[model samples]
Target: MEHPILFISLILEKLGLPIPHGLIGETFLEKMCQPYMTYTWFVMIFLVVVGKLTLSNIEMIPGKGQNFWEMLIGGMYDFFEENMGRELAEKLFPMIATFGLYIAVANLIGLIPGFMSPTASINTTVALTIIVWVTHHIIGIRAHGLGYIKHFLGPIPVLIPLMLFIEIISNIARLASLSIRLFGNIMAKETLLTILFILAGAYFAPLPIMVLGVLVSLVQAMVFVLLTVVYFGQANEHAH
Candidate 1:
């Protein structure tokens, strides 16, 4: 599977850079979406809506848009602040909330005809996992400097190599686990819905599943955010 958001290559191609068509030389466009655009189009739309909602509010007394933004972002702020401390939460809110809200929107977008959630693609989930992994580590290094790597060496000096290897494996596992969990749930849900509509030949058969899918989507997004918080906390342990 070629990663869908290879924007650098796409831009280069647009500029007449002459991208070769194979393996490392070429990038594949996202194939899942139809008619005109892929899930990327929906992602762009979601970002635009979120941007308008968040940026259009500039008053103390809230209007409808401000109220909506406050309820959404404020609740997330409180949740992370309580769990991860005010300073860290404030620093992390933009990235954390963006991922959480984006995933939720992506999942929900599938309910629309002719649209699919970007989260349904493993490429998308893997990209998100990479972002979370890299961001937390960057925070860790910034917070602890040279001492940040000690955590991977284990509590005892004698077992440093073994522990370091284990830690490396564990971190890699986190990337895979995060990506697969999101991808499996989303792909499974969509697949089941398709199966129901085709096999059972009844629209009613998928209604209950669709309702359940909404709940699953919300939970998955929260779980992704919560896991990021856990990583963030782990990385910044020295700060406290």
Candidate 2:
């Protein structure tokens, strides 16, 4: 099947820039500028620019921009607090917010004519899963010290072997679940939208699906954040 053309790469080529494929031909720049990676960098830069603009001027009365950001940050903080408790929310608000914004933007960008969602790439999702996996384990170790091992070992001494094996498998499964879930959903969404637009042969025909895509994008991002919060909460808990 023919894939949708990544307009970002096309633009770079037109601008006489070094791109991954046609212009650069098998070079290091080509390796670095994979479609997903290029869009990922765009998302990061977009977030950084928006954040800088939002924080550049603090107003007591709060303008429209300020109010929107305040509502977004405050609402997200409340949601995290509700799910993970105030203390954990306070500790993790920044990381969770960053993940939510990045994922949400990355997902939505693909719906635009020129861009593709980075999360559609398994490599990108795997990287995100790895970060969450390592972070929660670190949180567990820091919270419980060496006793974190007891989390994997059941209370009964006789069950340690079975419990440890089960826990190891479960944790590995978590990694796969997180990565594959995001990657599959996004890949499917992008592929379906692309095919729908092509089959319909008109831009307006896919309007309803595009609207649904926006909702799916936001819901997926929220689901990812919620699961992360749950994992952190579990890691923060005392051994049962």
Candidate 3:
């Protein structure tokens, strides 16, 4: 599949620092040439720099950067606490916060002229969904020990086989659901902006769409995190 060329890649080529094409060959891990992967690296480094700056100068009187981060992170923590209660929230906040921050940033980065949303890629979304699936199972196991398997079994012993089959399929469906939803939304937003730019010219075409895109980015991130929390909450529950 041919990927769209990005402004960043063009600049890199012009400066004699072109990103390697398919640096890993044609294996499943071959994303080096993808514009989305290039921007994924960009978003990671961008987040790290912003995080460092935000935490570097902790003032007795909070500065703008400190205050902004405090509000964002603190608000998210409070949200988790409310949904999952204090104990589970504390246990899961770091993972939840990482997902929220990364998705939110990745979704918005595409709005910039030289960038693309990593979440706009199916591979990125699938990888994220797999992480959530694995982490939630680990949480369930830690909470329940070897009894985690009971989650797939019904209360009635006679129904265990049937319930297990159904539950297993249901869990697999979640992986598809999470990945496709994020990828579809972000990809659609990017496609729409491209069409509008072509139809009406860049300067005047995309202003309204960009505004809506910002809202979509934040809302989608929130929805993904909230669903993840719900899955974690379910896993932590003692199976009936």
TM-score of each: 0.79, 0.90, 0.87
Off by over 4 Å in 2: 21-26
Model 1 stretches astray by more than 4 angstroms: 1-37, 50-57, 201-203
lDDT of 1: 0.76
Q: Which candidate comes out best when scored by lDDT?
A: 2
**lDDT tens digits, residue span 1-240, model 3:** 223557767876677654557523354434465567778888889999999988897988998999999999899999888877789999889888998999999999888765788898898999999999998899899999999999999789999989999999999999999999999999989888777767785468889999999999999999999999989888988897
Question: What is the per-residue lDDT of model 1 for residues 1-240, given as tens digits with 9 covering 90 to 100?
Answer: 233334444655677665544323333432222212345565767688877866675898887777887798889899999778889998888889988988888887765544566787777899999999998899889989999998788888898889999999998898899999998998787767666666664547878888999998898999999999988988888632
Misplaced by over 4 Å in model 3 are 1-5, 15-30
Which TM-score value belongs to model 2?
A: 0.90
Clash pairs, model 2 backbone: 20-30
Question: Which should have the higher TM-score, number 1 or number 3?
Answer: 3
What local lDDT does model 2 show for residue 75?
92
